[model samples]
Target: MTKCLGLVAVLAALGFATQASANQDVQTLASDPANWAIQSGDYSGHRYSKLDQINASNVGDLRVAWTFSTGVLRGHEGGPLVIGDVMYLVTPFPNVVMALDLAHEQKILWKYQPKQDPFAAAVMCCDTVDRGVQYAEGKILVHTADTSLIALDAKTGMEIWKVKEDDPKNGASGTGAPLVVKDKVIVGVSGGEFGVRCYITAYDLNSGHRVWRAYSMGPDADMLIDPDKTTSLGKPVGKDSSLKTWNGDQWKIGGGPVWGYMAFDPALNLVYYGSGNPSTWNPVQRAGPGGKRIDQKWSQTIFARDADTGIAKWVYQMTPFDEWDYDGVNEPILTDLDIDGVKRKALTHFDRNGFGYTLDRVTGELLVAEKFEPDVNWATKVVTDKSDPQYGRPLINKKFSPFETGTDDVTKGICPSSMGAKNQQPAAYSPLTSLFYVPVTRLCMDMEAFKVSYQVGQPYVGATLTMFPAPGENGNTGAFIAWDGAKGKTVWSKPERFAVWSGALTTAGGIVFYGTLEGYLKAVDQKTGKELFKFKTPSGIVGNPMTYMHDGKQYVAVLSGVGGWAGIGLAAGLTDPEDGSGAVGGFASLSSYTGLGGTLTVFALP
Candidate 1:
């Protein structure tokens, strides 16, 4: 049951070897704009397609082509994977994978239902939404809600191999998508709020053999940190970086969850990912300078590791001594840009700390950091070394710091609330316009930190927060903005009544597509941010949008449901007026607009 080695042998004995097709290769995935071969649409994490069949010039004529209801309604967060003429979709909770024949009016070719444990529902920190699945070597790789990593045949719904990746009993689950690199299938664990010391593991794609595992905490050996070699900002981390930063083996339970997206550069042979916040939001309990340090080292940090060996190559801490739970787990989007005339390989990320960063992906050097949201007050600005100028660090304004409220006191009037200017939703980058399309919410929070004791299988969170929109924002809750990453500024923004919770999709057609929390799917001009088209769906959308070419026509598709931390109060009808914090009451307005829905909607030109 726990990543069985013999099960793979049995599968191999049954002639379950992966079948490779010409289009399944990595080169085809990088160049083919008609097929979404991998999650994030070809690994650059651009979420942009080159198919210009649905251009902005005639976008107003777009119409719904077909729809499929998942039947089980809940929060849906990820989009589908389209390969050849088949589109693969994964649902929430039960973690069902359905193969839709695109050429035949979206016929359901096959469906795979794994044996999922019901207890996983209680362990998930957010709604029961699986990000998505990956397709490689003729196999469909899925990470279930119950911590299981499975591979199924693409042509059929046959199970090839299954491995238990996380322990739900220990407050660990798997909601993230699997990333396949060549013959290795990489997956990360979730549950930072449960005091889970997270990790990333790789398995053989052909046979489910566990390769190497790397932890986010513990000693240097466990973290795979070669201090003398692992550099950050052009300097070495020395030795025992992870252990020296913790107090008395506290690193064992120190939370640094990996619940978000990851990117890889085959040329650099490094995989990029960001670690989540430390356990127990109460800084009084988790903060300790064990060795000569003054705070936790790696919590809320970004790491670059050798893809094959799982060894740390470079790391950069975004929030040192994190007191506000601004998770550094946002997607590290990789791209190349011309900065001040020099073209450099950059990793663009919209951090929860309210800053959009452009870093040198090769050496982990910070290039530019600026606010994407105007209401950010947790930090004055992101500054760099006085001598080097390139070694940037956040100049946290203590006047607005959450710690100013005292150890056991409540902090009020913090801008860009605990949900952050952005959360788990991913942004997109278009090579045609060279602009990053970002989905963000504008809000502030009132937080109160309390002491908490660590207990297995129980919540380790020690803070309660009440979130509401920022002051004087004209009652607008969210906006989809086109960001100029090179200039570190916003190009244009489209305001919405609710937070834009869905991922964006930009096409060569000069159109950007996104969904709103109030259930409206809209398309706008990629250049001017002018509304080109809008349609009301059945429910709020938290999933990402995707596009594919089938029958020589481009189709846009997205999953819609009314569930996530943002809409939890609505979907569950949780009207806890006297809740510990006023968060439930503050967000109760969402229910009035939209409720629960789980359906896959596809649109195309008639």
Candidate 2:
């Protein structure tokens, strides 16, 4: 007994349980494709694995290896994490964390499920989705729907440290996964519709001490922005940047919720993320200059900030004076590309505003900006000329603009519903194919703008919308497309009956995998976008698909649960055809196909 005790103590002293030695372990594991270490797979947010054991030719032979039930309802947005011989899974609300031993007959090694107030679900905007979990060193990180971030022992499932990040009762909750960057874990808050000010906070990984908190929109100090240092369009953003954009203390509730995938660049020591839509979705209520560009400074913008100090490096506003509720909370994929005979570092982003943008991740230079959806008509194009005073702003078509049409008027046939061309479903970039596999929502809407007064922690949205499939596209509502980010072109597209809500996975096998709202896990040719193999899941899949290798066999896994905006119309019995408050009545057709469920399916070549 004395000898065993000393051995355990020696192991702990040798980079076993301490947080200071955690970064190197995570970095090494993340560098490996055999283990899906982080939420984005790697810091680049590529979601592409380098394992080629299950190639495109053999992917069609994939059979069910095993399955597990999360036993929770609502949407599951993120995927699972696999490290060594264990698989970690997290649920939606009560946020149950399960560590399953893969070596054995998939035994439950340990489970960590929290008990909390059921009323915490009220603060959630949509389907009460938890993006998933993160693992680093020997700890599993979880962000709960009730505004809590927890770290647990990877081996024993014991609580290492837990912190209350926000007040769910006060209308601020975090649904996305927390990202671990070196010695810190970063989290972004969500409350755009609740009129609550949002920010991204980073904490010390070891002691759970708050390191920095940067607001989405506020004064320079609160935002942690350097007046003459942080820049846009290659020029300094002067003082009062966010303050001058709003009227009076409106910036207090300025809704720039950074509640989505954030990618980091270790070489540059910068982290990149986008903010959500501004408060009071009604354009008329958020007053601005009529003919000029309303610089809602950081909302609907991409921000590159110093990971350690939380100082803004640069920013690019995707939508200036956004009249539509296009939250710019999608992932920014980092990679190097040769653009127009010049080899440059590129950061590609698919915005909720129906445009795919590629910029220099290092310098924040706009290299390519084009409409991934051919029918997108919100704005003709993004102005990319740096010299133009109108640079980085969209050339709006006033006919579809709610702001231009004035209050109480309904704007008709605005392509790309407030959901944008896509929501938080992440796109996968294959460095092998030089193409991005994107899951698209071909949705459009008719929005009516009105007046609304903001009250503390209350819903401040002032718009009513009715959604439908984009016109002239048969009756299909979604598609899987292969895009060339350097050229801003779609190489191939395959239409889907419903929105392709799952996150995409592209492996060295040359196959792109994603799930459909009809409960099918599909594999398509990475080169041609041809459906090669597909299997019906237990329910509609809104979660991301992930790939990992254990015991020399490649395994692909995905979570299936139908409760996002597209399926919530059925899950919650919402009957209004024009309902657009998170539950889209346009997707009522899903009632005939799927219902509420939560299951994880794994596949491997037989």
lDDT of each: 0.83, 0.87
Residue 163 in model 2: lDDT: 92
lDDT of 1 by residue, 317-366 (tens): 88777778888888888999999899999999998888999888989988
- In model 2, which runs have C-alpha deviations exceeding 4 angstroms? 1-22, 289-293, 580-583
lDDT by residue (tens digit), candidate 2, 2-69 = 99999878866653543333367777898888899988888889999999998878888999999999
- Looking at candidate 1, the ten consecutive residues that score lowest on lDDT are 15-24
The candidate scoring highest on TM-score is: 2
**Inter-residue clash pairs, candidate 1:** none
Candidate 1 wrong stretches, greater than 4 Å: 1-26, 289-293, 385-391, 577-583
RMSD of 1: 6.9
